[model samples]
Target: MTRPKISQMEAYMIETLRASGVTNEAIIQAAKEKDVSTWKQINDQYDFEQLLVLAEQDFSTFEEIINDGYAVKFVTVGGLERLLKLKFQKVEGKDFQKLKTGVQGLDLSGSSLDELKQMLSINWKITKNNEYVSVLLKEKKDFA
Candidate 1:
């Protein structure tokens, strides 16, 4: 990853860890080790609570997007992850029906299909009815 991307991910991780009541010392340690692998380790170890919080926030944002009839075409891994989380939650069939109701559709782009699949822990057999989210495995040049 590039320096700025690493920095952004670091900042995001720090904010997430802080929100989840992680200790300042741990945060400092994470900050001291600034690299993609280290960040992934920190995220894997500490991102559960924050991911739930972010998923809720993303759901609210999606609600607004649907309300205002916004045609969303998100071109970021974060966006794709948000959608995937919602989709996974919905598939789990636990108090997530409200998300699919009155929804048109959205386009979600990520770095690679394989990369995103690797991030998923569960086997999600998403069907056509659950096609509210359209996936776009975008090349790096498209982002540039």
Candidate 2:
């Protein structure tokens, strides 16, 4: 017997539902009925929206600490990978490789702070006070 094919989105949704403890029987029933409302109803029980808010808050706090002359170093790939896993829960090795490749392409070896800031294409202010260098991201108006 030939198996029914499902779209990538459908597969992803089914996997998510399964991971969230929805049974295979329930998934099959939803598929047969052509109704994803059951999956949506279960999904609505989770606080994913609040999770996003909390993640943003945490990132802002980290950025603030970096801006305050506290160095946040990722000394090893393993350490960075672990942090990514903690923040995202699931990050594939290929994704990390792509990220590393993109970062490596930046090539900031010979660039000065101003050049690096320009290359980043964001409103970043670099403040060097005697011993410490602080990089802060701000709005264009703040820079002006």
Candidate 3:
């Protein structure tokens, strides 16, 4: 079985951050926020929803979060993925790559309710908007 291990580069960065010389705020924040374990499990291994879990929780209806600010209820499977993909699909450059419907072995057909949520995140590129906005599905493969 393949296991996740912290890369030498990430360790080097962490050590560099620990050193007294580096004093940049963003770099310091990056050092504090970076996780080696997350980096490992994320490479074509863990589900895409793992990234979404780290994102800010949003409520369609204010009532859901008003109760405890923890409970999330996805109304429909397609609704959620459509929301995510529509919100995150990348559209830029002179020529933008069109996304195929296959990712992490997730097709629109067999993916479960929870699995669909893994695709949601704040890391999306706004491409265009005539009637609706287009978003690129930033995948696990994009991570360093």
Cα-based lDDT for every prediction: 0.35, 0.37, 0.31
Ranking by TM-score: 2, 1, 3
* TM-score of candidate 2 versus the correct structure, residues matched by position: 0.28
Write the residue-wise lDDT of candidate 1 on 48-116 in tens digits: 343334324454442332222122222244433443343332222232232322112432234333333
What's model 2's lDDT at 78? 42
Relative to the true structure, candidate 3 reaches a TM of: 0.19
lDDT of 3 by residue, 1-144 (tens): 111222222323322332423333433333244433433332433332322223223222222211212212222323334333432332233213234421222223223323223333323333333433343444466654
| Per-residue alpha-carbon lDDT of candidate 2 for residues 44-117, written as tens digits (9 for 90 to 100) | 64433332232245544323322221222112334333422332233544332323312111212223433333
> What is the Å distance of residue 137 in model 2 from its true position?
35
Deviation in Å, model 2, residue 10 alpha carbon: 1.7
Q: Which candidate model has the greater lDDT, 1 or 2? A: 2
Give the poorly placed runs of model 2, Cα more than 4 Å off.
Answer: 1-4, 33-35, 42-90, 93-96, 99-144
Q: Write down the lDDT that model 2 would get.
A: 0.37
Worst 10 residues of 2 by lDDT: 101-110
Task: In candidate 3, list every pair of residues with a backbone clash.
Answer: 49-118, 88-135, 88-136, 89-135, 89-136, 90-136
Off by over 4 Å in 1: 1-15, 18-28, 31-106, 112-114, 126-144
Say which candidate scores most in lDDT. 2
Worst 10 residues of 1 by lDDT: 1-10
